[model samples]
Structures are given as structure tokens and as C-alpha cells.
Target: MNDMLRQIEPLIPALRRYARTLLRDRAGADDLVQDCLERAVNHWSQRRDDNPRAWIFTILHNLAITRLRSSASRPRHIAIDDAQEETFARAPSQEDGLRYRELLEAVARLPEDQKSVLLLATVEGLSYAETAGVLGVPIGTVMSRLSRARERLLKERDGDRGAQPVAQLRRVK
Candidate 1:
């Protein structure tokens, strides 16, 4: 329906971003989004109206998990072109760009559960309740995972900053 299209159209970019973060491959992410959209359209009648965004995200999250599990044993390959394009899309400043890439690498190193919670809550700006609904986890669980994710990232950033003990100075000279 036109109404459904209008509502779903606006969410495509966010869905794609989440998918790319989860899968770490643009083509796979795009395919996942397409599959999610198809599934959403097919199940629109059954979806509750109270929280369509959560519902849609739930669908995409579930699909992404499934895809990840299925592909866990396979080796991943990235096209050089895609890699170059992504590299060119970052911030112009070398320092900012390096920091951004490091942050993304830190995120990628996170456990799946924590990564999902972090992305849903922070990157997508979903509330705890909404993130909980999308991930089908308790709010407390979401909070715990998010806390761990944040702490881990902070530690990583600190480590990258070369945190070290300062030499003690003599009391008098």
C-alpha cells in the first residue's frame, strides 16, 4: 500500500546502515536489507502498529543473525573497489580519519551481542526498550551489554592514547 511504502521508505537507510555494521560487507548488507524489506511487506498485516520501527528492526536483526550463522564457516572476501570507495568516504583530516577507523575497528572486535546492543542503542539511537524489543532481550540485558561495550571502547581508546604511569618527581630540588 502507499501508506506502507511511505513509512518503510524512510527506514531503508537506517536498516542498511545496521546491516552493513552487522555483516561488514556492503553487498551482503544490501541483500539483507532487501530480504528484510520483502519480509516486512509480506508480514505487514501481522505487525503491530504500536512500534513499527522496532518491529522492522527486529526483522532485519533476525535475518542478519541468520545470515551470519550460516556464513560463519566461510571465508569472507572484499572487492578492492569497495575497499577503496569506503576509504575515500571517510573524513578528510588524517588524524580524524585514523581515529574514526580505529573506533570502527574497536566496534568490529566486539562480541556479537554487545555489538548489536551498542549499534542499536547508540548508532541507531534506539531507546533501551526499543533496542530490547528489536534484539528480543531484556532491558537489563541490553543495558549490561551496552555498558560493557562502552567500557571496552573507552579502554581501547585509552590504550591507543598511550596511557602510562608518569615518573615520580623528587619532593625538593
Candidate 2:
């Protein structure tokens, strides 16, 4: 329907962004978004009208979880082309770029639950209630997971800073 298109069209970018953060791979994220769109279209009649954003997100999140779980059970195999592509990947050269990469690595190190909560809340700009609805968890659980995620990231940042050598002053008098 035209009404459905009008509503869903505006949400594609957000869905793609959320999918990218969830999967950590651009191609996989795009595929997941496509699958989610397909599923959403097929189930449009069943979805509650009160919150289509949350509903769509819920569908994507569930599909992502299923994909992640299934993938975890299988051994990972990188194709020769993919491995060769990694050799050509650019490394961070500037201090800001390095810091940004480190931040991303730190986020990647977070437990899946905490990472999901953090991404949905901060990266996707979802409120606690909306995040909880998408994740199918209590709002309090979302709050706690987000709190723990922030604490862990802070600790990781502090640890990285502490790992660097500090310059000591020499007595030159």
C-alpha cells in the first residue's frame, strides 16, 4: 500500500544503520535489512499500528539474533579473496583515527547483550522503553545493561590510557 511505503521508506536508513551495528559487516547488514524488509512486508497486516518503528526493529533484531546464533554454531571460513582484501584494508594513521578505531574495538569487545543494549540506546537513539520493546526485555533490564556497558567502556578507556608510558620529569638543577 502507498501508506505502508510512505511509512517504511523513511525508516530504511535507520534500519540499515542498526543492522550494521548489529552485524559488524556492511554486506551482511545490507542483506539483513533486505530480509527484514521482506519479512515486514509479508507480515504487515499482523503488526500492531501503534509503533511501527519498534515493530520493524523487533523483526530485524530477532532475525539478527537468529543469524548470529546459527553462525556461531558453524566454523568460520574466510575465502581467499576476502583474506586478500583484508591485506589492502587501511589502518588508522592519525591519532584521532587510532582513538576511534580503539573505541570501536572496545565496543566490539563488550558482551553481546551489553553491546546490543548500548547500540540500541546510544547509536540508534532509541529510548529505554523502545529498546526494551525491540529487545523483548524489561525496561529495567535495558537500563541496567546500558549502565554496565558505560561502566565497562569507561574502564576500558582508562585502562588504555594507563597502559601508555608517562613522561617523568628529570631533576636538572
Candidate 3:
């Protein structure tokens, strides 16, 4: 019990980083991380020998999927703080800031599956097998999704923002 807690403690920063990347909203990311921690602590005894990082990540991923899937069915209220002061260490140059913002927008625009696969494998530094375990997909599928995600981000960064996104085709026979 204490061992599990100690192990999970070190993962807090990594979990928060992954959650923030997965969810752009700060409050939502914090909520997700909190929920993941709760679940981990609750199931610690049952999962004593398993990989704690993977277990927590899987829980977090599942929770995010459920919320994202149901979001359209519910109305969400967002509170904006108009007077919030922005703070940063060594603020980036204007061009750098613009590029960073563009990268975020591109990642946000990716399909949910591709985005998850990319963020988990790259940003979270998870192996293909580990990402597959988290997402409950085959390793090959994870690889394909990650590859596609990288390609899409590259295309978006190179192309004009005003260009229309390619549409998926549906066949009606």
C-alpha cells in the first residue's frame, strides 16, 4: 500500500503533463488526473504486481474517452477569467509563440484516436506496446495511428491554415 503510493507519487508530474496534452483545458486535465489517482489508490491492492503507470494511464484514457464521447450530449459551461495575468519563464519570441500556438491548434485538430496514440507514445514516452495497452488497441494499430498523426501534423504545419481539411468519404451503394 505504502509502496504503491510512493511509486505513484513520482508519476504525478508525468501524469499531469500527459493529461494536459490530452486535454487542452487546465481544469479538465486536473480533474482527470485526480480521478486517475483516486482509481489507482482504490485498486492498489488488487493490482499490486502490475505496472502502476500503465494501469493509471489506462484508467485516465478510458475516462477521457467516455467524457469526450458524451460531451456532445451535455451542455458544458466554461468560465473565463478576464483579468487573469499571463506568466511565463523567458517568454518566447513572437514568431516562436506563433509557431507553438500553431502546433497546438494542429494537434487539437487531429482525430481523437490519432491524437491519443500520438500523445501517448511520443509525449508520454510510452512504448508502442504500452500505448496499445493503454488505448486497448493492437501495437500495429498504434503504430499506424501514430504515423498518420505525425504525417497529418506535418501537412497542417506546412499548409495554409485557410485551406479546407480533407473530408472522409462515405459510400452509399
Task: Report the CA-based lDDT of candidate 1 relative to the real structure.
Answer: 0.92
Candidate structures ordered by lDDT, highest first: 1, 2, 3
Give the per-residue Cα lDDT of candidate 2 at 172. Answer: 100
**Tens-digit lDDT track of model 2 for 1-173:** 88888888888999999888878877788999999999998999999765588889889999999999999898767666656564567985899989998888899899988998998899888889999999989999999999999999999889858788999999998
RMSD of 2: 4.9
Output the lDDT of residue 2, model 3: 79
**Collision pairs in model 2:** none
Mind giving the per-residue lDDT tens digits that candidate 3 earns over 1-173?
A: 67787889988888888888877767788999999899888877766345778778898888887877787688876645522244224556799897997898899899999999998888888899889988989999999999999999988776776486878899999
Model 2, TM vs. native: 0.85
Check candidate 1 and list the clashing pairs: none
TM-score of each: 0.85, 0.85, 0.81
Q: Across residues 1-173, which tens digit of lDDT does each residue of candidate 1 receive?
A: 98899889989999999999998888899999999999999999999764589999999999999999989989876667667564557465788888887899999999999999999999999999999999888999999999999999999999846567768888895
| Global Cα lDDT for candidate 3 | 0.83
For all candidates, what are the clash counts?
Answer: 0, 0, 0
lDDT scores for all predictions? Answer: 0.92, 0.89, 0.83
Tell me the spans in candidate 1 whose CA falls farther than 4 Å from its real position: 77-93, 160-163, 166-173
Name the 10 consecutive residues with the lowest summed lDDT in model 2: 78-87
